[model samples]
Target: MICVTLGRGRHRTLLEEWGQAAEAGAELVELRIDCLRSEINLKRLLTDRRTPIVFTVRRGADGGLWRGNEEKRLLLLREAIVTGVEYVDLELDIAKSIPRFGKTKRIVSYHNFRETPADLDTIAEQAREANADVVKIATMAKSVADASRILEAAARSSEKVPTVGIAMGPLGVFTRVLGRKFGAPFTFAGFNPERIFAPGMLQFDELRRDYGYERINAQTEVYAVLGDPIAHSLSPAVHNAAFQKLGINAVYVPLLIPNGKLRDSLDLLSWLDIKGMSVTIPHKEAILPMLRQADGAVDRLKACNTVVIKDKVWTGHNTDYHAAMGVLEEAYGGATSDEVSVLMDKQVLILGAGGVARTIAYGLSRRGAGVAITNRDDERAARVAAEVGCRHISWAARASTPCDILINGTPVGMHPNVDESPVPPAAFRAGMVVFDTIYHPENTMFLKLARERECRTISGVDMFVRQAALQFTLFTGKNAPDDLMRQVVARKLGVTRD
Candidate 1:
């Protein structure tokens, strides 16, 4: 079941927001009365309810806004219960003091802001001993193992009473969606993406539309993209749309795996039966040691961006190399033999020395192109150049040397910073090729300046779509719907076809 949590200061029109949640298929609406600026009028909010309502007046100690005295808070909850609400959420500390009203079940809740305690079963037993009709536990997760503990606790305690367990943060998002499969009666979500009350609350539309929450069961397959700062990824949108189009019983989510935790995170993948994953950023190189088998491309590039799991073994592959080289070859199509030979020896200058930069440089060098690397930190640039058998150029001298192709492998022109460019406009020359690896702002400042100089330009969307299509094929063993994947990504990024 999906429960939409509503807090004050997030919505100007409370009733309208509640109505919209109901229309969006919310099974329950939780009204956080403590978040209100003034006293709530129970009759006004409770009348004509389309779905069951849960009244929660949480105190400040439990990560709530209620600052009033305990007596007044209990009185307010009692009044709400009298209004015929379906449930009243009472923290475990005050559960015994508050008298339950007829037909209004009490949900005894416990929250730990620091970490998941080792004595989780003892805590659930304590809530049950306090006469709770339902038990809810939410704890902050410092690692993926913390979330695994919470899921185990919830599954073990469900026989005693209906339970809701959540690991709160980006590191625990997988638990929030997988809770229901582990015997959780319901999972909570924010009314909308912008008005979230918890750290890792899923958006209502994402649970309903992207995950197909109602249809998800134990047999459904799970997939995710692992990275740090993964909130802005569009992979979920593209992959979920493909699954829906193909009628596959699978769900894809974003997993924020911090550095040094790839091995631990992969351990949980087998425990949870995750079928596939897309690796990005720092993890592309870090995940190689954890794989049981890898493709030839991964061995050549020393990086893997896609991993497929079967019979508890992980096989890694490099889709970025294929994607980058394919786009470059297509852009130089129909050229004369002399021009083609020039491309074979094209002077390619790359920005940044990260995973993506390494992949591009290796692919180009193998094709017999002369590649140069430049970065803000000259040491890192020299390291990458040495690894790829290319020359390292100082950042200050990048513009003095001319190149046939300039590629921005950095995140300078990514979303929310669309005006920033890694290279100066003077670096762009007429008839030169300029490419950026940021797909969100389809037109970055670098691309704009390159176009004005009459240089042939390519957006990162082409590379992103091609690589994602390859990952899809690897996961499903079927021909990917390339056209549909392009359309979904373009629509999400608000890029219109010319």
Candidate 2:
């Protein structure tokens, strides 16, 4: 079940939104009385409550907006309990003071905006000892390990008492979706996606539609995309949709593991029994060495974008290599029996010398295509070109260099930066095949220019879906719903094409 948190300054607005939340399929709502500008009118708000509510009167210290005295805050909590609110959220320090009354259950919660405390188990026990019917722990998670620690504590405490463990921020999203597996009764979500009720609080619709949170249970296998700056990833939506379509009992989430923290997160990810993961950005190459064993793609590209764990062993694979080759082949007029010979003698110019760039360069090089790499950082471009046995092209000379195909491995034309293009307009010649690996905006400025120049275009959507579909198969050992995966990604990206 998902609880929608509603915080409005006016009672009328609050009541209207409460009904709206119900209409939107909210099973529960949290009435944050602390946000009211006027005096509290418990009877007026509770009279015709449309859904079960977790009544909360928060103070500033606990990431709430209440600016009144503690005495008044405590009085409001007690009054709500006396008025028979379904649940009341009391902070750990004051949980003992609020006596349990009637049928109102006590949700003793702890909120630390700074960091997840080291003694989370001790805090959970304290909430339990304070007569909490449900213990809620919300803290700022600095790393994946911090989120893991909160999850571990919740799993342990739930065996004895019901516990809701949440680590705030993008890194902690897993806990909210996977908390039920650790025995949380229900997780909190914001009624409005645009509102900032709490850091990292997912909107009700997002949890329901994108994550399929209601379907998650202890038995549901967990998979996630791990990387830094993971906020824009559409992998979760794509994979989760495929899981639902294929009737696979699993959930995929986005985890922001910043650079230098991947090694530390390995044990924690294993501890959570994550069945698989999709690695992105900086970690792709970093993860290659950590794998117990890897496929030929990983060995050749020196990068691992997919990982499947079994019996505590992590096996890595590079789905990007195959996905890129497949899409490029199809765009180049379908694959042949000798796929490697298709691109032979063709000159390919690749933009950005990152992981994706490296993968494409190696694939093209292996297929006997002449490849040249260019980046804003000339040194990195030169280094990658040397590693892939490809020639280096200066950023200044990229547009003038003659090539039959253009591959954008950089994020230069991704969402929000949709107007930016790595290559100049003159670079796109007629009959050239242009491919942009940034999928968020299906038609990037780079692709648009290429189209205007009469070049055959391939958007990142095709590659992303193909790669994610491959990951789905690796995760479940089942043929992926390719059409469904493409549709989900296209719909989320607001594009009509596959």
Candidate 3:
């Protein structure tokens, strides 16, 4: 049986939307009092209660919209419990602050602001220590690998009670649809945008129809991407297509977690049923603290793109390194001898200073290429440069140097606003390399301008394919069909082949 959170926070949509959802055979209907603007008469609302009801007055402290301080919020939650609601959700922090309840069992939870926590046992212990009836953890996944870790940890947790594991992001969406497969009792869904508490949540219809329950299961391997602005990701198109082609039961989706909450997201995964996830920008460095063990490459990179929960412990790895290497090798076929050296000689200029840049920088360094990174985020660029041991360039010097391979690592070329390219054409050198990670529109202005100038170029599509293949390997524990994966990516990117 599956329960759907019909409306979020204090939304009045519950009376209509939740009732309709219940009519659709939804096993449970959640009334999120936290979203309501006025007091809810739970006693009056449950007069003809048909299904078991779960009531929550979510606090802003834990991924909710409620604004009341801890004391006031607790007063409301206790009122709901005393009013005879079947289950009441309590933020683990708030619940821990108060003494244990003698009668009501609380659904205690945590939310991540940065990235998913690296350990489930520790997360679950926190929830357990609070004496929560159902421990729920939700983290912001920076990549698909993060989603996998959330699900895998949920499946691995040793708990005396049921737990809800979730990755909150566009990349975490896959985990929402598939959480049940990993022994999770519930997966949150966004029925109305006005009421959505988390980011990149699928509408209830999309969840039941496009990403139906019959597909994902306990044996189904999972993967996803976690990023701040993930709506532009073609990962779903790539991974879902591969799953269909390979006759695999798995699927991919996105999750969005705002800053400072990735750890809470990982706590959700600790309720142990997920597989693994992909980590992304602004989170690779921030995610480091949560890992139990990061050996060899993972420790060396001090960054993680894939998190695996084996035996309830989350061990991190950096498959993005492989993905980055593949992207460089394929896009610049003779990367071994020609292009990289040329790029090194010319001091390749990179735009955007997020996780993608981090991996790409490392990849470029391995090729003996000197690099310069510049972005609007001065601090982020500096940090990324520090990680790659490259020179930090300023946005003011956009055209200061003739870049051999000027790469745009930002979201400037993505769709719905596809015309926007970060660097002006006047900045390009006739024989330079212009690489744009934007693949959906293979000929972004950045790439198109370079084409007109006869400059060498690479599309982010190559990187997407390679990273996805690495993800496929991580999820299925099988060697990926590299050629097949490339073709799939090419088709999705609308690249016409010779």
CA deviation > 4 Å runs, candidate 3? 1-176, 179-212, 221-233, 251-255, 292-297, 335-346, 376-387, 392-394, 481-498
Supply the global lDDT for candidate 1: 0.84
Report residue 106 deviation for candidate 2 (angstroms): 1.4
For model 3, residues 392-458, the per-residue Cα lDDT tens digits are: 8788787776666788888897764677889777888777767788776767878887888788887
Question: How many clashes (backbone atoms < 3 Å, residues ≥3 apart in a chain or on different chains) does model 1 have?
Answer: 0
Best by TM-score: 2
* Lowest summed lDDT window (length 10), candidate 1: 334-343
Q: What is the Cα-based TM-score of model 3?
A: 0.56
Candidate with maximal lDDT:
2
Runs of candidate 2 exceeding 4 Å displacement:
338-340, 495-498
TM-score of 2: 0.95
Model 1, span 1-498: residue lDDT tens: 888998774334667788888888888989887887765666777777768988998888778888778888888888888887898998888888887778998889999878899999998888877778888999999888888788778878887787888999888887888777666777888976567677888888777766667666667788999999797788887887788889888888788888888888777756678899999877988988888999989998888999999988899999988889888877888335665433588999999898888889988898789999999999999999999999999999887779999998999988778889988889999999888888878888889999999999988998999899999999999777889988878776773222
Q: Compared to the true structure, candidate 1 yields what TM-score?
A: 0.90
RMSD of 3: 10.0
